[model samples]
Target chain A: MKKLKLTVAFDDGDYVVYAKLHYDRAPNLIAAIEKVVPFSNPVRHARICESEWMLSTPYLGVEDENFSYPDPGDISLHRAGPHFCGWYERISPIGTTDIFASVASEDLEEYRKKMGRAWEHPGAKMTVDIVEVDA
Target chain B: MNPIAQELFETGDRYLMERPEDIAAMRSRMGTRGQNMTVQIYAFSALGSSVDAMYLLQEAVAKDDYDFDTVVKFAVDWLSTLAPPADGSQGAAIIGHRASVHYRLDQLADLTSRASAALKQATTRAEVREILQALEHYYNQVRTWIDLEFPWHELAVKYAELMGDPAPRPAP
Candidate 1:
């Protein structure tokens, strides 16, 4: 099986998250993302669903955008910038995004809880590093 | 005015007024999905407002859904026939420079080709829908591009004259 994955390491690389790019489903987005391998960012946590879901908008200069209604653990690529919105609950975007990747390894509920608890500490931040996860 | 140009003006106006409102709702419900999808949809929806009637006719008459594929192939094939981008800051160039447009359009071509390939291999409806979402977004980009530079007749004529390809065929 062909597996194309990205490692999103955060919190000083302590929390390692692995996601698989659905190249077959979102070829344009995957292709655009593949060009900019090793996309990483450290941004203030802005909870979208839980008290922990990180909202990041790192511009990767890619133009392949989409409207993606994703389930829990799915990651969306915003239109212009390299924004990320990870779904952590029974939630769906009112519209859609370039839903390019999915978090397959980590437990969504657990990740959310951990992130929620960690966020309680003042000045808590999440550094997300997305790199190619070779299979 | 040609029907294409007329339609473009009318279509663009409708979306320009309507989509912005939808954007807020979408953003509120879906986070950045609103921020991203609305920009894409409105831009294209505006452009689709004024598509070339002939192209629309072709799309209507065609037996297969080759619209996306055809558009991608045209953008790529036409660009390949020209010289590569010249040296300079990509942003420094005039917003409407042929080379600059080609540079970005080339990227757009790659994006569309990838989407087309993915659609061919997609299995589930969910997968197919996402692929379509991406395709429509990019496809609108080309349209939005046109919408930005309205009165395309001048641009079209100038393109023909500069490229010296009066008979350059567009993909069907």
Candidate 2:
């Protein structure tokens, strides 16, 4: 099976990072995310969970699957706000989440800086879409 | 110690016991069916209002000399307003059946207790402001829980009058 990849672009593609979909662990969530690829939304910082960006996805209808504490660069779907979360920096576990993808390790630093900016200056636009890549 | 700070400390201590009791009583009343959804709606309104109150408090603290006595007085007054009258007046009642609410309130008690102790030691405006900031952080945690637990738009629609219209108020 070909592993899926997602492109996360911040500020209208000014900063871009690649994430690999966890097809094995969260196949259903991955499928749900696929349907919404090429999506754009405003991103905000999380209040409880430190060093993370929350992308509102009120449209998602998936349930919990493989929910657990996230490491840096992990992307997960949190059904409460129905937020698509991106953890760019190490964060303490507020609660478990159904992770579907993770940013490339090499891109973690830049991703951390971009997501951290939402703390000081929120309402930045983030675009997500599937990308052709071998992982 | 400033008299206002002393009063705030006392108020905080009172709330550590009173607020949770109010909610627990509300939960008991709710279980009896003596009260209706109106009580829960009012309780939700109280929770919603706290978010606004925190924001206002934050603004007041931003000023260098923002009248500490007035701020303390407001804080003292607002703490009481969170609970409905135990006598069940004005069609209001407190509501908290979910263990999460009780647990969160316990966490809130810790913050208040810390704030009260800090009140005794804080001699400078900056110190007081820091205490307020800590309170704001705790409020934010509760706000997050509320957001996760309840749908504000649905609540606003169902209890339109109690929830108040979401008019565009000027930013604080």
What tens digits encode model 1's per-residue C-alpha lDDT throughout A10-103?
4455555566777766777666555644433332233234322443332233444555577877777654312466664555456666777776
**Total backbone collisions for each predicted model:** 9, 0
lDDT of 2 at B48: 45
Q: Deviation in angstroms for A41 in model 1?
A: 1.7
Please give the TM-score that candidate 2 achieves against the real structure.
0.44
Error of 2 at B114 (Å): 45
Q: What is the C-alpha lDDT of each candidate?
A: 0.41, 0.54
**TM-score of chain B in each prediction:** 0.30, 0.47
Q: Write the per-residue lDDT of candidate 2 for residues A1-101, one digit (tens) a residue.
A: 34434334445566667777788789877788778666655566665676777764423445578968999989988653345788887868878888888
Residue A119, candidate 1: Cα error in Å is: 5.1
Q: What DockQ class does candidate 2 belong to?
A: incorrect
> What docking grade does candidate 1 earn?
incorrect
Instruction: Tell me the tens digit of each residue's lDDT in model 2 across B8-54.
Output: 33443333213334344444434234653444555445554654565
| All candidates: DockQ | 0.01, 0.03
